[model samples]
Target: MVKYSEVIWMLVLFFLPSQAWAQQKVPILIYHSIDEFQGQGSKELYVTPENFEKQMIYLRDHGFSLLTFEHWQDTSKVKKPIFLTFDDGYKNNMKVYSIFEKLKTDQFRPTATFFVISDFIGRSNRLSKAELKKLADSGMVSVQSHTATHPDLTKITNYKEELEGARDAIKSITGKPVIAVAYPYGSFNSKVMEEAKKYYSFGLSTTPQYYSENGLKNELFLLPRIYIKYSTSISDFEKIVNGG
Candidate 1:
């Protein structure tokens, strides 16, 4: 049974011109922890579990199509579509996965990418190989790399171990092709970009801007993303979607 709101939302999305969101870059919101009680990171990064659910509800009820990292390409003609990404392979990310599982649907399927540290897997706070494989096998979610030890990519002396090791580790665990690498702590440089190219198709950063085809004169490795903190109000979410 379709709800009246769902019907209206779908109508608006299906009828809108694909180019309508051209001026505004599509938002790729980055998250860290999804717990009720705060952890070690900045409080702002810890979007409460309640707020997380509210956000998913808002996105679903308001016509937003949640695209997976691989499926993000399907949103070419639509506006207000967003990519939800999480980094640092926290054990608590399993909690976030549960939230997404509860919200799954055909049209409004929520997609997420977990960028994990290769060395952290099996540790107390990181995901194990089996867990990584499970998430990747879901086909709706992707398990990518942060780095082998979560080092600053730009600061590393040997680029090979820093970048490729993580790529290989994730591939071996998930048996999925690893294409994207999110910069640890959003740190990067030209050297980092060059190193990233050897192993990845996308290198995401912390800059909060919409992704637009028009302004991307640089290589695809320097893809910028929006940091979605607890402080970001629903109005801010609106602006992010509309590319304001």
Candidate 2:
């Protein structure tokens, strides 16, 4: 027989909310050119290969589990789950592959999502079809869609071409399911979300916040991503991932 005080304690424990034990804040970091900035494009968009390597090392040393959107369900299951995303499929992003290779261990297997522009493949500065396929097949990167021409989803009238067409193109190249789309310029509206739902399981935006489930409608389609830019120092990266 339990005492009255023990019975009261058991009742409180049984009624505790499950959310209190669930992982809430998940950092979804976005990067573009993971290479040195030339005079050609925005300097802020370029995170140097050295700095990118340091950031990954920090994550590895600090016990972070690097993830792609393919492992999204594991966010609640894994310890310190975070998503690394790259946009535009820049040719320089191959540096990221090299860095991940150098840092991978049995304990730390780095993975990321490459949101590639379907029609821009094989451009002088973008990843060619063969290169994109290589990365996708490496089992370290998930190739997703950034639309056929990187058009702002909110302003586009041809939803089928930009959304479904882009998804199909990436699926053909990667031979893997294309389940996510990062909106060009992080632009989207209600119509965009509706169209995206038809093609993607998740939709990413440049909203600069860690993801926390809020029970909102279509919340998966409105996922927010924080930019990991050239100036994002290790300390800043630490703070961002730590939910500070």
Candidate 3:
């Protein structure tokens, strides 16, 4: 005979949709310079502060939310969520910080990660240790590791020195746990991930895609990120967050 408990279980299963391995596709956008054409590839990584404001505004007005490293990572064995990150410690990021302070709302609070090079802090055109530390203390920014020398980790001869050294250096300055990493030049390999696990909770890459449970089993290690650019229009920005 069908008991009340058995009947309820059957009804729940019959009505509930399958969510076994399915995960929401979240974009982790990557940006580099927030100034004029200063880096390689004709300033591809650089986006003007004006344009940056527009993009942030676009995310604000739209339903898209800014996610932090802590937010994107899983706590209960779930897949990672959407994230936005910047690399290579540029000075103009302070402008982004100010804009975030003035414009962000509770519903639109912006969360971002900055991957900084340990040795390059306070070198001139880059952010100083004080600036980076302040941002880290703000509790809004997730300051992660970009290695001490910004070398391609996949090609490095010493994984322990490259991976652990950067984590240690950042923790010293920020007084926060450096749990995430962005590969210098967006480079990574299986062996690199193997060694990286010894130090980081997550790592990022420059690949143009989103994270899902069905792919990249180390979803934590090899997360894909969208490249925000100078020429990106509002429509293009919409398309990116909407996964176009």
* Best-matching candidate per TM-score: 2
Off by over 4 Å in 2: 1-15, 18-23
Residue by residue across 80-161, what tens digits does model 3's lDDT show?
Answer: 2357788988887887688788777877777678998888888897889899888988776888898888888878788777
| Worst ten in a row by lDDT for model 2 | 14-23
Best by lDDT: 2
Q: Candidate 3: what lDDT? A: 0.80
Clashing residue pairs for model 2: none
Q: Over 4 Å off in model 1, which ranges?
A: 1-24, 215-217
Clash tally, candidates in order: 2, 0, 0
lDDT of each: 0.79, 0.91, 0.80
Model 1 scores worst on lDDT over the 10 consecutive residues at: 17-26
Q: Ranking by TM-score, best first? A: 2, 3, 1
Ranking by lDDT: 2, 3, 1
lDDT of 2 by residue, 162-234 (tens): 9999999989998999999999999998999999999899999999888998889989989999998888888
- Candidate 1 structure quality by residue, lDDT tens digits, 1-244: 9999999999899768664643545678898887755466678867788778878878877888766556656767564677888988877788767877898777677778888988889997778888888888877679988988888877678778868988997899998888889999889888888888888888888876767666554546667788778787877766666566
TM-score winner, 1 or 2: 2
